[model samples]
Target: MAVFNPFLPSYQADPYPAYAALRAEDPVHFSAAIQAWVLTTHEDCERVLRDQETFSSSSDTASGQLATVLQQQRREFPLGEVPTVLNSDPPVHTRLRTLLNRAFTPRAIEGLRPHIEDIAASLLADAGRTGGRFDAVTGFAQPLPIIVIAELLGVPPEDRDQLKEWSTAIANTTNVLNTEDALAAARQATMELIAYMDEIVAQRRAAPGADIMTALVQAEEGGERLSHDELLAFSILLLLAGHETTTNLIGNGLLALTEHPEAAAGLRAEPDLLPSAVEEFLRYDSSVQGAVRFARETVEVRGRTIERGSTLLLLLGAANRDPAQFPEPDALDVARSPNRHLSFGRGVHFCLGAPLARLEGDVAFRALLDRFTELRVAEGGAERSGTLVLRGMGKLVLEV
Candidate 1:
């Protein structure tokens, strides 16, 4: 049996080869490192994500690897007490998503296109004056989504820096490995985040604004509205989900483009292909790499029986690169059509910010190509975020 330890620094640096090996030989293998079943194939991953009955999405205390990983911290984490979209199932999940969609409707998100364009253009213009080089993660990619989401949520300009600081801490909690220090930081961050959101929600109630936060706070349907706990949870979810993944999307997508100059040249020549190029970048190197699910009942997959209450880690990265699902999956093809990659995941829990992420990606690539004739990776390579569950560049310096 081949070992699948994604936590190792070497594997974190380049996980594709290991993912490829798993997809080929051990599509559904047990990873002693994570102490859970690792699902690599696209089909398996889709089944696990969609079949919420057999596999639960309950983030905490679901008898899965997550529950086991942070047995102590979760019990005290303030966010754990409230039911959010990420941790809820069925009626609860359906209700939270409904209230959320009221504020995050397609039209509502699309309305921010002009705003996204402005932010992207401004960031790139500022980077341009910096002697033809800038750290994409800090200067552009990281701030883009934070500013956009802060605007959407009606967070005041003066408060966004603090919000980003809290969000960064919250996002850091879910490291690939559930270490004591990480969990401790996560617990503290969760408590602080919930409290901060509570304050903002209170303010929104008193003085409503034309923002998602206000809409979410006041959203009502059939006499059903978000309770205090629900509002706080949803706020936390929006704050974290809105920026974190999109930041990675831009960073990873730009980095991938720099690596594959042919694709970059094609996009530069035919900018219309930027949309497809973003999809390929997602498939080739996704932002959120894997997800965890708890088994609701004894389930047999790939001739192996996983007992009920067991933890399962679905490797979305590996699944995206499965040769069976994607031909020449290793190669980066900007114009690959029928690109049904599971980057935003599948089923109900599919990313709500997906539309916004796509819009942002389109804006970002255009801004980069339009501003600079030539973009090259800096000599120091990348200081990748020290986590496999979330593949992102912490410092992606680029030279033009």
Candidate 2:
């Protein structure tokens, strides 16, 4: 049977039909093209994520387009050498995650709330002056996250544009480009970012400051701490993951509101509903579409037995819409109560930046709604990012 390529232009234009079809007929069907089983049900997705012992996160076992991308670039960006917390399992993942958690503590992120508000207000002010018409994605959504992430990483304000370009290149290199070139670009970007971070680390080492980087350099648990390379890798991961995902969240949320005016109006009437509205946005159009896992042992999920070493691709986007877990699964209801969406993921690998992301989303949407009295899609249908794993609009034009 022909396999479904969700990244294709046709699917990007309207993926719900395909998702519904998969859920009904092939929730756990194997694809020869991708050489992996695609899980589309909510229960199965939760099982794969919760039972990490049975399902590994090794990219080698990640089949489909994502696997092809990794396979092509594995040599330069060998999955093993990189110390990203997202790819590890068990004790190692626990340790790395614990160390990183200190940087994003409640107090730490809360401290930046004032700064975040300032950024949002300034961005909106600029947008208002531009005659109440702008590319929401470029003018507002993209810049807010990038600026906040740059500030958090101790990146000098002068070099933020360079950081943004490098980060965008790294994200883009994941799709279409040859693995070698993509890997080279990633490595080059990593090196440049690390060189810049090295200066911050060195300065912090000399004179401790209030930044997370400074705190991390001095942090130690039982005399065990991050090595130089580990620090560099973790820092880069924070910079990329922190902004990129939230940027999409804001863009996708704005686009969704514009497309569904009723839902947008409901939010405008009751600003208190912003939290649930954000959840609906995550469920309706998740930022990260799916995640990869390797079957550590033979496991039966949703009536299918997955063989040891076989790869499993859990479609979070599909799971969010599964009727078993959600009532009125296809509707965009701003007052969606009991909205337990998996946009930030689940289990031990749950997004450390969730709090910050939520805060940003809440502040951003409220600001956008208050500033613009009349908001509608201005130009072009939403263009999704080419990457298969990360689901988001590439651009969304809005007029107010």
Candidate 3:
């Protein structure tokens, strides 16, 4: 199969066609541009995500733009380490994940439901007062997650803007700034966040609070507390993963609802379906489009052999739309039950914040419907961000 740049703007706008072609003609196709084998089939993607031994997530060979960024600032980037929980295989991954799991306990997330609902309600009320025209991304999607993360991290509400600026500087795809500048900004952000966390940790050490940060500060494993670097990395991961992915979830789900009126009407009529609708939204258009993994040894997938040390890009978006896995794969079904999607990932490295994300999504969509009686796409089509790994709309203007 001929290799092409999947990061091109054209591909970003509509990757389904390319993904369909790949899944049909070359499910395990290798691309020189990305220097990784593309896994497009649903079964293959699940297999790769589940079997971490054969396919490593250590970021040993992440090429293209992300590779450049990681190589330049290996020590600073939490993900640069050989294997953080999100990027590690078992044992180490298991240990790290186990240590962090207490923070995201089901009771903790459930306890947060009221707070999340309140935040969504307040934001929706503001949107309603604006006479119906609002940028959904800015008005609702962005603020809800930012506030939730800020509250979770115990960061001052006033400082939330700076936190977002830092995250955007590092993660924004439209920023044409040089890699050095981006790295510098990321390093500065890391230091600032760490400094803030250090103070919070000190306070927590002196007198623990009920927040997750305090819990983490006081957490003990085999009579061991988390190292400073580990704590910092874990905090950064939680903030980034917590906000970035959920931001896209809200944005993408709203976009889907606006585009599909019948589905939206169904959701409005039956609010109970919102949870399943969120799941279907995840399946139809996932936030994390693909995850990178390194091949531990020679592995044959979809009739193609991937060499050891090579990178593999498991196309989550493609897998979600695989005709073999989903009936009427392209259509958006709000009531699609038994939706087993890899949007939150799978296996040992599954997303720890999945429960929180679901809760947030359900609250967000329900509040959105309740607040806006008439909703339509203010802008007909979505402008997508250019990042290959994360896929989301750049802006989604909606007339509520």
RMSD of candidates 1 onward, in order:
1.7, 2.3, 2.5
Quick one: ranking by lDDT, best first? Answer: 1, 3, 2
Q: Which stretches of candidate 3 lie above 4 Å from their native place?
A: 1-4, 61-72, 76-83, 172-178, 380-382
lDDT of 1: 0.82
Instruction: Report lDDT per candidate.
Output: 0.82, 0.78, 0.78
Model 2, which residues run further than 4 Å from truth? 60-74, 78-80, 176-183
Residues 197-310, model 1: lDDT tens digits: 778788889999888889988888878999988887777777787788888888888888788888889998898998998898889889888888888889999999998888
Backbone steric clashes in candidate 1, count: 0
Candidate no. 1 TM-score: 0.95
TM-score of each: 0.95, 0.93, 0.93
Model 2 clash pairs?
none
Stretch of 10 with least lDDT, candidate 2: 71-80
Distance (Å) between predicted and true CA of 40, model 2?
Answer: 0.7
* Residue 156 in candidate 1, Cα distance off native in Å: 1.5
